[model samples]
Target: MTDARVMRDRQASVASAARRLDDASGQHSGAALVQTKAVGAYPAAASAYYACTPLRIDGPETEGAAVTFTGDPSRIIMALNLGSRIPPVGTRLIIHSSGGRWAFRYDG
Candidate 1:
């Protein structure tokens, strides 16, 4: 009986660990500097961008960079990494991973 109890505990621990790993793995991480053009709305619009080249992706920064950091900036849009989040600083394109399954906060 003791052996069975021990085995059950170990299995539970393993399952918990696996769940954590799975959740962590899916979490995106990274940021980049990308140029963008005014498409559709001014800023309320999301995922409505293209051509995220001349990018300078790096470590963690914001939700924007996290979802788009797949080691490749291609097939993603990046926000301007300068000035204000507005036109004065130029609208920045939030970078995302493939298929645009990511999201970002409201820009300023």
Candidate 2:
């Protein structure tokens, strides 16, 4: 009986952990910096930004970088390293979305 109980508890714990991971991952989405076009939205539009060559925008400092947030999935946010000259469309930009916030990174 004790062994059964231990096994049940372990299973429960594993299930709980898996649930938590799934819930967390569901809150975020990823996309790439395809094209930074000048939309009519002014500041709300995304631009071909530059960062640290191999730029990464994931923190508060990213506020100043050239980019914009539309909403969620599809066109959530678009950005690039502050120093990198606008990469061509289809540039793979690893993106993370959490609580309606975004972070950008160039895996290249």
Model 1: weakest 10-residue lDDT segment is: 80-89
Best by lDDT: 1
Q: Tens digit of lDDT per residue, candidate 2, span 1-108? A: 699999999899877654433211254234332333333332321333422111223434554676543322333243434332444443444444333334454333
Against the correct fold, how does model 1 do in TM-score?
A: 0.25
**Candidate 2 lDDT score relative to the true structure:** 0.39
The digit string of per-residue lDDT tens for model 1 on 7-92 reads 99989987765443321124534433444444444453343333333334456776655543323323334442333234322334
Best by TM-score: 2
Deviation (Å) of 107 in candidate 1:
3.5
For each candidate in turn, the TM-score is 0.25, 0.26
CA lDDT of every candidate: 0.41, 0.39
Candidate 1: segments with Cα more than 4 A from true spot: 1-29, 39-54, 57-89, 93-100
Clashes of 1: 7
Please list the residue runs of candidate 2 whose C-alpha ends up more than 4 Å from where it truly belongs after superposition: 23-65, 73-108
